[model samples]
Target chain A: MTSHHETDIALDPELMAYVDGRLEPAKIAALEARLAHDSDAREAVAKWRHFDNLLNSYGRQADELPHSLKIAALERELASKLKKQHWRAIMLGTGLRRIAAGLVLFVAGWGSHAAYTTGGNMLASASHPYFVAPTLAGHAAFKLAAYQGAEFDGDNITSALDWMSQKMQHKIESPKLERLGYRVESARLIEVDDRPVAVFYYRNAENERVTVSVTPKWTEHGNYALRVVDLDDGVMAYWSSDQLHYTVVANDNRGAITTLAAAVQQ
Target chain B: MGLKSELHEHIGSLRRYALVLTRDPVAADDLVQETLVKAIAKAETFQRGSDLRPWLFRILHNTHISALRREKTRADAAPDLPEPIANDCQHTQLELKQVLSALDQLPEAQRNPIILIALREMSYAEAARSLDVPLGTFMSRLGRGREALRQIVQGVGRGKLSILKRKGDSA
Candidate 1:
């Protein structure tokens, strides 16, 4: 037995239900009829709906996606300098906090600064970094680039991908770049910004070093267009699909990174 | 898509709500990052094919709560939790600052529902579950919170909005 006051208290939530479209179609018609007579109820509905729209709109526009924010940068030195300081600071802080590290060396993977890689004409068609290789994704890729020869956490490719799939929400599969003459030399986990990302180091017979890293991004959508930045000594290409954001960097751009990027996409 | 990927899809929404909840961009970023790490680390505990949105949100909600408890412990005096951060407000647009500012006036109990349903586009039921409240309780808070939000928002009133807590729903 619901009293008049209880009904009065409930009416506003019912009206809110109407605004949210959660009220039954039958209920909405009756509510609308009552609201026609009730000015306050009508205003509440409008206010609820208006606030909803305001928030949703702000959410869509303000949250910067990695894909949309890739404005070109002519200068990579500032980014690299910041990158070094950022990682070095994080490394200084990470005192053996490992989920799975049999290896003794927790060398601050921060010392490995991103190779300076923004050329002016190279970005005429391609997207360049607003903060070249400094955003979390770029930082993960470039940070790993410096952590080469940091003990192999996984002895082989299968184990490495398996370890990553276990540690990360994104199931990172091993890229088969071996067909293009790139083999996974070793795999290891490195912490960037206090989050762990698995880094794979690939070396071809020609002594060319190609590095690949995968990090998860909070995205509105996973279809970020491939963006590339040319380093003075290397190239970095990155893209996203599903939940995983991939970065491929090579000290020597012998089309091996390109081949690996294509294979990783496949 | 697998289980983790489904959870990953809500990352942006999670971050936005985190920002709304904490109002400190740095704290919000930390909350989101910690939430992701926890979800990914505890993936098996999640049921397969279930709505990961609410589940992921629950993790974030609980993480924020735990952080608060820890903060309370660490500090000699905790800053009043619901008080909005002094506004630098560079992250969102100038126009929407009104809504964000209005939201900051709310208690977490009230603010959570609006943010979950409005910004994250979650259903009422899902929002309720995310905050771990009964459906009726959620609706009551939502109704009161929404009304208060309207009054305090741009052009409504300069009068501060304060909806008293309903006994147990003390956020």
Candidate 2:
């Protein structure tokens, strides 16, 4: 709203309004009449008009760009978007596996070690730093599994291994253990220190259900350590390898799980 | 389909301004792309229902300045002036190149205002908003930019020796 007739050589804000046709009608008429008659005003109006034309020319030239540049940019953006999606998928799978493992471990203990190895296959040694052993049903199942004639449920083993393999960055197979006279019944994933452990259940004809668990060594930790626990007619063997740690629990005799372990090692 | 699409429509104006600012299509495109990439990645920063064109131009301006600074330190970078000063002064094409070089040599504060007013057709208000400055400041810059360009172009047209001397000193 300032006046155009400033004393100094300063730019007149009203000049822009005048050029843009935004001035009041009376002001515009006066400016136009002055511009037509006065030489300086005429020169200023011509300069502004020429500047406007140049701006329009530049705008038009800029608009006529080739299509190739835009397409290339869009392609690059799409590829990065696809890569981001792939990373998201992998992260989600890892998260689900950890959550599933946590839930299983929570249920197994339920706040008491006694609750963890119920039905007495082989009790865990209180002295050992690592594993708590399996119970009677666990031991019996393991024995039957060791002999190859055992039949047990094999639900969720496929999914558990699928998830475990991806999480551990290693592979696990239940049917491969079938050659050792053991068949997986139910396999559940457990987490220790945020790493996944695959627990496989097997039952033999002796009605002894054994538990063999395999987990990534990186997921567990430490060197090759084996613990053997003998409890009320049941035995449990715990060992580990470079890639994975394992636990086998069985009953219906001593050294039965040892034989099964030997077969698994072969 | 949303803000991104709408903003993309302003690329033409951005490219035009950049072309005038840099006077090199390849360099202009690079600045424009950097501006758009920064805009899209930080799209959340944009306030709702605001004019996107000015924001995009501001980013383009900042990017050009940063690139120019980096280019200064880079060895073997071509100077804004064309090389092998063609002895053939009669060629109009060479004259045009000389003019462009002069435009590039102008100070950013002077050059930018001219480009926004002359090349981008921005209102003083819009240019001020884009520049995050007051309208009076924008007009002053525009006036100074025009006066400086007029002096440079006038010097170029009079004779080769004076213009070449100015170019050497400016470069």
**What are the TM-scores, per candidate, against the unseen true structure?**
0.44, 0.45
Model 1 residue A80 lDDT score: 33
lDDT for each candidate structure: 0.59, 0.56
Q: For each of the candidates, what fraction of the native contacts does it recover?
A: 0.25, 0.18
The best candidate by TM-score is 2
The regions of model 2 sitting more than 4 angstroms off are A1-10, A19-25, A69-266, B1-5, B73-102, B159-171
Give me the runs in candidate 1 sitting further than 4 Å from their true place: A1-11, A65-266, B24-26, B69-95, B154-171
The DockQ-based CAPRI class assigned to model 2 is incorrect
| lDDT (C-alpha) at residue A168 in model 2 | 66
**Residue A150 in candidate 1 has what lDDT?**
38
